[model samples]
Structure formats: C-alpha cells, structure tokens
Target chain A: MTRHYNFCAGPAALPTAVLERAREEMLDYHGRGLSVMEMSHRSPEFVAIAEQAEADLRELLAIPENYKVLFLQGGASLQFSMVPMNLLGQGGTANFLYTGIWGKKALAEAKQLGFAVHMAGSSEASGHTEVPTQAELALSSDAAYLHYTANETIGGLEFDYIPDVSVPLVCDYSSSILAEPLDVSRFGVIYAGAQKNIGPAGLTLVLVRDDLLDQRCQRIPSLFDYQAVAEAGSMVNTPPTYAWYLAGLVFQWLKHDIGGLEAMATINARKAAKLYAAIDSSGLYSNPIALRNRSRMNVPFVLADERLDKPFLAEAEEAGLLNLKGHRSVGGMRASLYNAVPEAAVDTLIDFMADFEQRRG
Target chain B: MTRHYNFCAGPAALPTAVLERAREEMLDYHGRGLSVMEMSHRSPEFVAIAEQAEADLRELLAIPENYKVLFLQGGASLQFSMVPMNLLGQGGTANFLYTGIWGKKALAEAKQLGFAVHMAGSSEASGHTEVPTQAELALSSDAAYLHYTANETIGGLEFDYIPDVSVPLVCDYSSSILAEPLDVSRFGVIYAGAQKNIGPAGLTLVLVRDDLLDQRCQRIPSLFDYQAVAEAGSMVNTPPTYAWYLAGLVFQWLKHDIGGLEAMATINARKAAKLYAAIDSSGLYSNPIALRNRSRMNVPFVLADERLDKPFLAEAEEAGLLNLKGHRSVGGMRASLYNAVPEAAVDTLIDFMADFEQRRG
Candidate 1:
C-alpha cells in the first residue's frame, strides 16, 4: 500500500507501524475474541490498557509526582473553559500571553467564563512574528494564572524560554508537546490535544499540579471537573475508550520503537533545522517568524510570489506530500513535522522545496 | 482467526464486516495513502465522508427535512447539560420521565445548570420495572420539553409508547437507537451515544427540530452550542474524526448488509422474544421487568437462587459468553443484545444458560 506523507495540522499523521498493528488486531485483541473497541472500559483488560497508556505518557514526559495526568475529552478548546473554571476559584484576574490565533481564542473563552482576563503580552500587532521576552511581558501579580500557547500552530511561533513569573503557568502545548523534551515541573498545568504529537483527536491530555486539583469551583458538571476526572483516574464518566486504546498503542510505539522523548527531541531538532535551512536558502520561499521563536513542529512559509500558492500545493499533493496548505487565517504553505513525521519525509520535503525554487527561478 | 462474540452493554460489538473493512483500509484508505484518522476534518475528502455519513443516517431514519442532524463529542452525558443550556430558554421548566439511571443523571445535570426540573413520572420506585403510563405522567403546559430515556441500559426498561405531549418530546436513545425502526419526526430532539448501536464511544448523534435552534441561552460556549454545530455540520470544532468515520462505516454496514431498520427490527424482535421466552419457561431464571415495557435491546435477568450468580457468570465466561454480570446498582445478569449481536450468539447464550440451570437443579 502506498503511504503518503500526511502533514495535516492535526487529526494528523500517526506512525505507520501503529496503524498496521491496529489492523492486524482489529478482529480480536490479545485472544480476547473482541476488538479493543468492543471491550468494556471497566473490564480488567481495558483498565490495564488505560493505566499503561497513562504510565507510558508519564515516563515519556518525566512528569513530576506533584502533577496529576488526566485523559479528557472536548479537545484543547474545552480546556479553555475548564482551566478557568477549575483554576479561577471564587474568581480572579488571569494573565494571557497572546502569540497567535489559538491563544486569542482560548483567552476569549476564558473571559466568557468570568475570568478578569489581561493581555500580558501580544504579538498580534506584529503579525505574530515573535514570542515576547520575559522583560517585555506584563504579568499581573493578582493573576490566578498566566496562560500562553507554547507553540502556535497557525502562526508557527514557539516560545524559546519559559516565562519567569510568580503566577501559576498554564500552557496550551497542543502542537509542540512531545516533539521535544520538556521540564514538567516548570508549569502549573500543561494541556495538549492528542492529534498532534500524541495520537488521535478525541483524547485531550492535561497534566496539572496536584495542588491545583483542590481549587475547582463547585457546581461544574462532574465531567468538566478536573478534580473529578483526576480522582476517577480520567474515567469519571465513560472515556473515549477506542481513542484511548489507539493512544496506548501510540505510547508504546513512542517508548519502545521511536526511542523515548530524549531521542525524539534530537530528531525533532534536526528535522526543524533542515527545513528551516532550506527555506532560508531559497529565494522563492520565506518563513516570517523571528528566528528564535520559529516553531520546530509547524513550519509555515510563504512563496516569494504569492500567486503560486495554489499551484505549489497542487504540485506538492501530486508529489504525495499532502496537507501542505497553511491555516486559512494565514494563507501560504505549512509543513507540520510532528513526532510521527520521519526524517526521510523531511529530506523529501526539502528536496521538493529546492527543486521547486530552482524551477521557479 | 477466532472471533469471540462480544456482549458488552456499550462499547459493545460492531458488525464483523465493518471491522474487517476498517482493518483493510486502516493504512491507506482508497489510495489516499493516509488512514481516515489522519485526514483533515476540513478537507474535501473528509467533508465528503462526513456528508455521506449524515446522508446515510438521514436515509436510514427517514429523518424529517425540518430537523437537523449533529455529530457531536462528549457523549450523551454532555447533552444532559447542553439540551437545557440550548432549549430551556430563560430558565424554563423541563419535564423528565425517569425510567432509570440515565434519565436521573440527565435530570440532575439539567437541574445543576439552573433549569427548573420537574419529574413528570418515574418508575424508579418500582426498581425501574416498567415505563410510566400517560395517565401517570404530569408534564407541565409551560414545560419547554419533556424528556425520557427510550431504553435504560442499566435498569433494562423501555418505553412501550411515545407519550402524547404538547411541548417538545426529547428522548435519549443511547442503547436502543438503530436496533429497531424509529419514527424520527415524532420527537423534537433525539440524542444517542454511539457506543451501543452506532460505532464508538467518542461520537454522539443529535437530531433536533428547526424550532429548537432558536432557543439558545446566552453564555453557552460556542463548542457546546447545538445551533453552531448544526450550522457547521458538526465541524465547529475538530470532531472525534476517527469515531465519526467508524460510525459512518457502521451506518453503511447497517443500511446494506443488515437490510435496513425494518429488517433490523424483525431480527431484534426475534432475539428478544427467544431470550424472554426462555426466562419465562424456566423456573431457574426470571427477568423482573414488566413484560410490556421490557427492553428488546437489554435483557436483564436473575437466577432463582441468587447464590448462583457468581458461578453462573464464571461458567458463562468459560462458555465464551462474556460481560453477563448485571449493573452494580441491580445485581443479577444483563445481556445487552444491541444491533450488532447475532442470532447465533443469543442461541449460544441460551444454550449455556439452560445447561447451567440443569447442573444447578
């Protein structure tokens, strides 16, 4: 079977090996006479699978003991409301560092839920070209938490350093998470939708400091309550069981075959460097983000001649490299190199970019 | 390859043909060179898949043109809140008919969200042995909607008739949906979690009337707004793409292979009749539910000697009939014969039950 390189922003590419294994085991899982999708979530068989997925994730991220790992639904967007609902106990101001579209949308959702939201820093005025330096940010002392997107999938900007602050740090790491190494202790909460570096779109991963668990506002539904999900081991209600199963397979694939997060980080860095170098060298293409803040996962670049954008994407599709179009908000080209993207695929993309540039010149 | 018949209540069995096709196409769907899971939700390819799924569902249910079908996330539990948030305009009362655990949970969530909740009728006092009669129900004239569970998975009860109501009729068809023919136009809204009769756990089906779209209460999150999801064709957020895809496959399988809803109804009736007849004829086992209101989808029964429960379940497991234990709230045995359950599997279960009874006697 032909395997095209998928570069969709999310509901994104998965490891080919995981998909093959899932296919082989689709009829009956481990002699259970039932597909993993058909098993009861409460059954010992499934409980073990869920627990192992969580354990593997913890090991991959080196998650601190003080944090609780939660597998939740409703995506990262839901977390926008859940984070404020859980963290903004009795109501207080929250600071936001706006880098791109995602951070803006998240802040908008938080504000609707009654948080006194403040823009600590914003790159929107500069077309989201750079991440704000610590000195340039205006964090509030009275803020319940400081929110930021670690990597902006749309604008393709990424933070190079953790913002030093006294307030609790909450980062939407939907795109950049697990693409490289992370210091788990640096933040109060880190949440990522699994579609990118993790697994599928249905499961959302939230790692919260244990202390943060007790601050949930009462009257929130049990399903939205972080404390409730954490207490029930993320099975507060029936979870997205099939997605969780696939995620388990993904975790296993990541740990054993892909080499743990440390090795993954090296590969991710090399991949990013190769693509960035190609874009910088080409007269026909340019990535607008400030060099220090350019995302290692989402590489958004525009053709020097804007009229060639559609033709560029069509040709790339014909070459079996798909979903290279940028976000509608930023019309150009984007090649997302998440963990599942192989080095050979990156080399292929670079080669195509060079050939295209030469042909256009 | 050996395939064990799965009898899980929800997250239950899927058609074997669908599973096989999914497995075959898991790596490269129709030469797209990417699994359906990897496709972008907004792409034309996935859009066609989503639209086709909705069209197939519409055709199967004979859905009215005045209604909208929404594919949503967060399961039926989220709808417990979303229904009130969307339909209970200005804190209006919504009448509930509590057949079992699901209705009570939905009512509790609506109450939490500030809806004036009233119990029109409830069979909980009789241990949910039967659905309430029309004369016993007391739906208010000012009620925004009247809610009921069409089939209770936990208590094994089902409605014998649709209640005549001036206000909108809303039903949670989580377990019984698609197992038999349903008149879609009779209700203002119908919702079902996909785990039982549809496909997987992460996706939910919502059919709402056009009139219900105008009742949105302010301050509901856009993601939770039924109107927003309906308008966007459920692409308002990154949906549970893989779950939705699988549900589409199940819809196709049901339509073509299972011979549509009428055929499904005939098969489901036969399966239920056989199991109920066995329970009635044998002095060794009894199903407590009232005959008229008993669920065709869920068959809950008790051994004459309650002490044999453990042995019965253990022996059943050895015989390859799994997950027969009843819900913890009511201890006995429950066989959820959803649409995917075959006649032979029911026959196998009956044979085992008879043999076990003879040994005990």
Candidate 2:
C-alpha cells in the first residue's frame, strides 16, 4: 500500500506504526477474540486499556496530582459551554484572550450561554497574526478564570509562552497538546479535542485541577458536571472505546518510537523551521502569521498568485501530499505538522513546494 | 481468529462483515490514502460518507422526510439530559413511563434538571418485569411529551407495542432499534446509542421530527440543541466518523444480507423464541421477565440453584460464549442477541445451557 502524507488540521494523520498495529489488532484485540470496538467498556480487558491510557497521558503531560484527566465526548465545542457552566457559577465571569478563530468561537459560546465573559485581550485587529503580550491583558479582578487558545489551527497563530496570571488559566489546546513540552502545573484546566496530536476525533481529553471540579452551576447538564464525570473515571457512559484505544496506542508510540515530548519538541521545531525557511526563501509563497506566533503544528502559506491555488492543490494531491488545502475560513494552503507527521514528510513537502514554484513561477 | 458470541448489553456485538470491512480499510479507506478516522468531517470525501450513512439509515427506518436525523456524540447518557433540555421548555412537564432501569435513569435526570415530570405509568411494582398496558398509562393532558424506553436491556423487558398517547412520544430505542420494524411516524423523537445495534460506542443517533426541533430550552447546550445540530447537518461539531462509517456498513448489511428490518425482525424473533423455549422447558433455568414483554434482543435468565452461576459463566467463556454475566444490578446471566448475533450463536448458547443444567441438575 502506498502511504500518503496527510496534513489535515484535525481528524488528521496518525502514525503509520499505530495505524498498522490497530489494523493487526482490529479482528481480535490482544487475543481477546473480539475487536476493541466490540468489547464491553466495563469488561476487565477494556478497563485495563482505559486505565493505561489515562496513566500514559498523565505521564506524558506530567500532570500534577491535583489535576484530574477526564475523557469526554462532544469535541471541544461542548467544552465551550461546559467550562463556563462548570466554572462560572451564578454571577461570576471569565476573562478571554482572543488570538484566532477557535478562541473567538469559544468566546461566542460562553457569551451565548450567558456567561459574563470579558475580552481581556485580542489580536483580531492583526488578523489573528499574533498573541497579545502580557501587558496588553486587562484581566478582571473578580474573574472566575482566564480562557485562551494555545494554538489556532485556522489562523496559524500560537502562544509562545504561558500567561503569568493569578487567576485560574483555562486553555483550548486542541491544536497544540502533546506537540511539545509544557508546564502542566501552570494551568487550572487544559482541554483538547483529540483529533490533532491525539489519535482520533470524537474523544475530548480534559485535564482540570481537582479543586475546580466542584464549581458546577446549578443548571449544568449532568454529563457536563466535571465533578461527577471525574468521579466516574470518565465512564459516565459508554466511551468512544476504539478512539480511546487508538489514542493509547498513539501515546505508546510517542513514548517509545518518538521518545518523550521533550525530544518531540526538537523534531517539531526542526520540521517547522525547515518548512518556514522554504516558504521564506521562495518568492512564490508566503506565510501570513507573525514569526513569534507562527504555529509549529499548522503552517498556512499562500501562493504568490491566487489563481495557482487550485492547480497547486491538485499537483500536491498527485504527489501524495494530501489535505494541504487550508481551512475555508483561512483561504490558502495549510501543511499541518502534527507529531504523527514526520520530518521526512515535511522535507518532501518543501521539495514539492520548490518544484511547484519553479514550474508555476 | 477464534470468533466468540459476545453478549455485552451495550458496546455490544457488531456484524462480522462490518468489522472486516473496517479492518480492510483501516489504513486506506476506499483508496482515499487515509483511514476514515483521519479524514476531515468537512472534506467532500467524508461529507459523502456521512450523507450516505444518514440516507441509508433513513431508508431502513422508513423515516419520513419530515424527520431530521442527527449523528451526535456523548452516547445515550448525554441524551438523558438533552431530551428534557431541548423539549421541556420553561415550566413544561413531561409524562414518563418507567418500564425498566433505563427509564428510571432518564426519569431521574429529568427530575434532577427540574423538569416537571409526571410518572404516567410504572412497572416498578412488578420488579420491572413487564411494560404497562395502554389502559394503565395516565398521561397528563398538559404534558410536553411522553417518554419511554422501547427496550429495557438490564431487565430484559420490552414494550411490544408503542404507547398510544396524544402528546409527542419520545423513545429510547437504544437496544431495540434496527432489530425490528417500527412506525417512525408515531414518535416525535427516537434516540439510541450506537453500541448496541449500530456499530460502536461514542456515537448517538437522534431522529427528531422537524416540528419538534423548534422547542430548544434556554439552557440547552449548543451540541445538545436538536435544531442547531440538525441545521448544521450534525456537523455542529466533529462527529464520530469511524463509528458512523461502521454504522453505515451495518445498515448496508441489514439491507442486503438480512433483507431489511422486516426480515431482521423475523430472525430476531426466532432467536429469542428458541432461547426462551429452552429456558422454560428446563427446570434448572428460568427467565424472570414475563413472556409477553420479554425482550427479543436481550434474554436474561437465572439458574434455579444460583450457586452454579459463576461456574456457568466461567465454563461458557471457556467455550467462547463471552460476556453473558448479567448487569450487577440484575445479576444471573443475560444473552444479548443483537442484530449482529447469529441465530446459530443462540442455538449454541441454548445447547451449552442445557448441557450445563444436565451436568449440575
């Protein structure tokens, strides 16, 4: 089978090794005579799997003892309402920093839910090209928490540093978690939809400080109650077991084959630098985001001539570099270099970019 | 691989053909160079898959054009909250018929959410062994909706007939959907967790009448708002793509191999009858559920001696009949013959039961 380099921003590429292992185990998981997809979530076999997955993820994030990891459903979209419903009880409000599309979306949901959300800082004026500096933030004194998007896939902007604030920090790290080393203890809650760096869509991994789980508003949905879900070990209902198992395999792959997140950071840095360097040197292509805020995971670049965009995508598809067409919200080409995407794929993309530039120059 | 007859109530068995197709396409789906799991929900390729799945489901159920089908996350547990949140507008009360464990659970959530819920009918006095007759239902005239569990998986009881009610009817068809024929026009909404009859866990299918989608309560989460999700074509968030794909495969299998719901009903009926007959004739084993309301999908039976329960389960597992242990709440043994479970498996189970009874009699 011919392997293709897939750069889909979310529901994106998975490591070939993990995919192959999943395939081998699809018919009968660990000689259990049934697919993981067919196994009972309460079965000892599946319980072991769910436990190991949480443990590995906890280790990878170096999550503190005070933090509770809950595997949930409804993607990051649910978290938009849940975070506020679970945190901003009664009359409290949250401070939001809008850096890109996802942040704007989260803010919209919080507002829609009647949460008194305050925009502490925003770089929308710069077309979401940069994150606001610490000085630009005007956090509310009575705020419940500070919410931010660590990396914006659509706008290709990333936070280079964790904000230093006394308030509880909540982040939508959907596009950035497990891509690099980070201080897990710095935040009150870090939630990510598990489609980018994680194995699959449909599973949202939420890590919240234990103390924060008790603040659920009276009207919050039972499933969205952090304390109840955390106590149930994220098995409040039948989980996406197959996705959870695949994610466990990914965590294993990252630990063994790719080494830890620290080593992963170095490799990710190299891939981004090489690709960005190629874009910078080429007169035919350019990335719009500021250098300091450019996302290492998702890099969106525009063709010198917009007319060549369709042809460039077609040619790239032919060359087996798939899903390069950027998000419709951001019209250009995006090459997402998640941990599953190897440096070799990035080199191939760079070479292909150079060739396409020469042919269309 | 040694195939087993798994009797897990939820996260249950899937058609072997569906699992095989998933395995074959694990690395590259339809030669698209990526697994369906890795495909973007927005891509044309994935959109087609999602559309086809919904289309096939609509065809199988003979669902009217007036109904909107939603592919959602969070399973049926989340729906326990969502149903009331979406349907029970301010000060609205719903009539609930409690036939079994699931109905009780849904009722509990509705009450917890402060929905003015009235118990229209309950089989609690009968130990959840039967469904309430139409004459027994005392539905309130001003009730927003009448809610019922089509089949109670834990108690192995089923409503053989749809409740005759004036109010819009909502049914939890989790364990019974696609196993038989039903009039979709009679129900205002039908929600099911896919793990039982569909494909996998984490994907919930909601079929709501177009007219009912308008009744969104002020506090409903956006993901739980049926109208919002339907308008978005269930793309309000990233769906469980792999589960949806597998469910589509199951739909195809039901349509082609089993020759639609009518034929599936006949097969299911036969499987249930054979097992029930065996239990009735044997002095050593008996099904507690009344024959009239006995579930055609899940047949829970208990050994007369009770002391042999553990040995029976252990030996059955060794013989490749797995997960027959009943729910902790209703302990003995449950043989769940979902659509995926072949009639031969039921015959095998009966044979094992008879042999075990003879040996221990």
Candidate 1, residue A357: CA error in Å? 1.7
Q: Deviation in angstroms for B334 in model 2? A: 0.6
Evaluated at residue B177, the lDDT of candidate 1 is 91
Instruction: Superpose all Cα atoms of candidate 2 onto the true structure and report the RMSD in Å to 1 decimal.
Output: 1.0
Q: What is the lDDT of residue B132 in candidate 2?
A: 84
lDDT of 1 by residue, A105-202 (tens): 98999888666899999987787998889999997667889999999998899999999889889999999898877898999999999899888888
Candidate 2 has an interface RMSD (Å) of 1.1
lDDT of 2 by residue, A161-230 (tens): 8998988999999998999877999999999999999978989999999988878888667889999999
lDDT of 1 by residue, B61-178 (tens): 9999999999988889988988888897665698999988999999999888667889999997887897889989898767888999999998889999999888889999999999
| Candidate 2 C-alpha lDDT tens digits along B1-361 | 7678888888988888888888899899887888888899999988998889888898999999999999999888788899988887655688899988789889899888877889999999898887889999998767999999999988899998998888899999999999987899999999999999998898999999998877878866678889988899998878888888888999999999889999999999999999999999999999888779999998898888889998998999999999999998878999999999998899999899889988986
Best by lDDT: 2
Name the weakest run of 10 consecutive residues (lDDT summed) in model 1 chain A: A214-223
lDDT of 1 at B24: 90
How well does candidate 2 match the true structure in TM-score terms? 0.99
